[model samples]
Target: MDVLIVGAGPTGLTLGIDLARRGVEALVVERAGELFPGSRGKGIQPRTQEVFDDLGVLDAVLAASGPYPHRMIWKEGERLGEEPLFEAAAPDEGAPYTEPRMIPQWRTQEILYARLVELGGRVAFGRGVTGLTQDADGVCVEFADGTTVRARYVVAADGGRSVVRRALGVGMTGEAVDPAPFVVADVRVRGLDRNHWHAFPQDDGSALALCPLAGTDEFQLAARLPQGAAPDLSLDGVRKLVAAYSHLGAEDVTQMRWASDFRPRAALADRFRAGRVFLAGDAAHVHSPAGGQGLNTSVQDAYNLGWKLGAVLRDGARQTLLGTYEEERRANAGAMLELSTGVHRGAVRRGGATVQLGLGYRESSLSVETRTAPDGLRAGDRAPDGTVAGVRLFDAFRGPHWTLLGAATAPAAGIRALPSAPGSYGPGVFLVRPDGYVGWAGETADGLGAYLARVGL
Candidate 1:
């Protein structure tokens, strides 16, 4: 195998699909027999969708999920505010990408898995990485079953408490700034008839939130549990939690689909890549699930690392580019850490933005020069989206496309001569990597020359 990925979650499978599509033989191993069946990450950011577009899997995601438009805030049964979760304003078809869709985590994994299989790759289930040792040539990964496979690179997409991270002697820093127990129940609640979220602040104890799942009548009921009041998660216990936090009485709460107890925590690995072994997804960073960024961040991490790894395998680029993986993504991880902490503090102290909207990159080489603001030059930030100008072939439905963005008014040659049709990565001047991070961000036709030179394109 060119690359061996530990943990077949969204991140690992996505990396597999990207590598397989690039004709890189990548192997994915998971401890679980199949994709996780849970109501994990429910929101997908627009930038993430662009990555899917690059992988040629965005349409399946849109079909599997539905657009999630509104995100609302509440405190103790009072609706504090509601706003468009993606763009601050309405999204036009010309926009780079619109609001993200909401889909269960399992379904998202299923799509990636299918794509991976289509690319002549398959996940090795019930296989866990027990030990790994890397030398200059490659890495030898030992499975729990006492089997070993050697690959040029090994990636740990395994969740926090990653076996590869531990084997590599990497340390994670940060703690659960605000420790609280919360119950997440993903079940069919009968006849609840509630369309909006209900938040109840408990000054005496933990808070509670009822977020309505889009495209489904079932509601995701989340509530802070008293130190010892956390339920055992039996059907009756799930019913009790729903009854207490929700207006629906105990009599009204009858059925439960699934439920689990989770604690909020945040941490980051001291290093993201070491030698031929690398860490990504929750393996590299872990944070509270409050902002709905856990899986999205992980998937994005894979997107950032996948192309770089493939580049190294094919062209053997400078090791510095591989080192930059940690520099770039760890910086994003640090931002997500702060975002997660902000949400936690808001939950604990009250009053802060709980929803993560367009959290752009900072201090990257790609950012364009612009006047500094309270936040750094968000200019040259994630390229803002708009309708494809002067093209009838632009298809908004087949998104996750690389948009060749420049001043439409700026004089550049052959902009019209570029591919004027939709592609797997969508119709754009050219496709960037699967990750939203731009490999080529050109403000003019000649600007592409500068970007290509930098990346040795």
Candidate 2:
């Protein structure tokens, strides 16, 4: 195989889909027997929605998700007030997805996995990677069953307690954003209206929140535990916690589907790559659940890496293209870590920054800006969605190819060019990369050939 991805979570599955569509020989291996069955990582930011759009899973995701509802505060069974959980923004020409959508993490993974299968990708479940050895040619991965597979490159998306990261001797350094442990569970509960997220704060410092999950009859229950208190994962324990924290009786919670306990922490790996192996998602960076940055950041990590890997393994690109995956994504992951920690500590709001629309790779080595007097969008910025020459910009840029916008002359073979729309893109020829970022910009296509050659376009 050209590439081996460990952990079939959103990160690995997303990479699988991207590589499959690019015709790269790749395989995804999961340690668990099946997909995760929890409501963890429930918020999908706008930037991630765009990524899903490119990966061809946006419709399914949108169908399964719903807009975030206002949080309804409750005091002793009496309604206090309601407030929006996220700052609202209207859609504009630059950004069509102005707000985040709420969907269970499991549903998101299912959609990605289905898309991967549709693209002729394969995933081996219950096959956990035990260790790996790398050479100049490829990486040799050993599984728990004593079987081994060799691939040109390996990606570690096995999550925070990643065995692949440990085998590579990578260390994660971070601090606990919140010292108190919390329990999150998916349960079917009665006596609660499904229109809003119900939040109940106890006299003690702990709080409980029950949010109605969209497109399902379940509710995600989250509660902060008392100091040094052990979390109960059983149905009885969930009922007790609900009764202790909220006005509803223990019997109100009818069914408990899944539950887990965790402490909110922020951590990033020392490095994202070691030889032929690369770290992604929770393996590279772990974020607090606050601000809904963890899963979104993880998905984007796979998106950043998938195309580079495909270019090197299938499109004859130089190995240097793979190096930028670490350089660009490590910095973005670090920024998201800080944002998640800040939101956890009440130092930041869950608004624009949390949406992740402003993230870009302007400082990356791959970004080439030739215009001396740049005005509007520059190289390395996200190519905004709009209509140019009667064709939607995103529609023209879709698929595994490069797009040149506003070019006076026709671009080289294999590059699609759209007539200049100075009002939207300013007076420059923009080379939009496969991942939807402007990789090169110039007054004309003078430096276009060289830039495309660098990336094997």
How high is each candidate's TM-score? 0.80, 0.98
In angstroms, give how far residue 35 of model 2 lies from its true place: 0.6
Global lDDT for candidate 2? 0.92
Those runs of model 1 whose alpha carbons end farther than 4 Å from true positions after fitting are 67-88, 92-96, 200-203, 215-217, 228-230, 249-254, 347-362, 365-380, 385-454
Predicted model with the maximum TM-score: 2
lDDT of 1 at 275: 92
Instruction: Give a tens-digit lDDT track for model 1, residues 1-457.
Output: 7899999999999889878866788899998787887666787766677668768898898888876545455554456776543334455443455565787777788889999998899899999778888899999999888999999999999998899999999999988755567788766666433544556556676766666666455666677887766556777777777666655556655556667787778899999988988899999999887656778788888877877776667654455667767877898888888877776676332112222235544566643332222132133244333344355323322332233433333222212222322222232333233244334433234556555445443
Q: Clash pairs of candidate 1?
A: 50-400, 94-386, 94-387, 95-385, 95-386, 95-387, 96-385, 96-386, 187-257
lDDT values for all models: 0.67, 0.92
Q: Across residues 1-457, which tens digit of lDDT does each residue of candidate 2 receive?
A: 8999999999999999999999999999999999999989999999999999888999999999999989999999899999998999999887899889999999999999999999999899999889999999999999999999999999999999999999999999999888888999999999999999999988887999999998899999999988899999999999999998888999999999999999988999999999999999999999999899999999999999988987888778888999999899999999999999999889999999999999999999999999999997899999999988788887887888778887745556556888775377788889888889999999987888898888776
RMSD of each: 5.9, 1.1
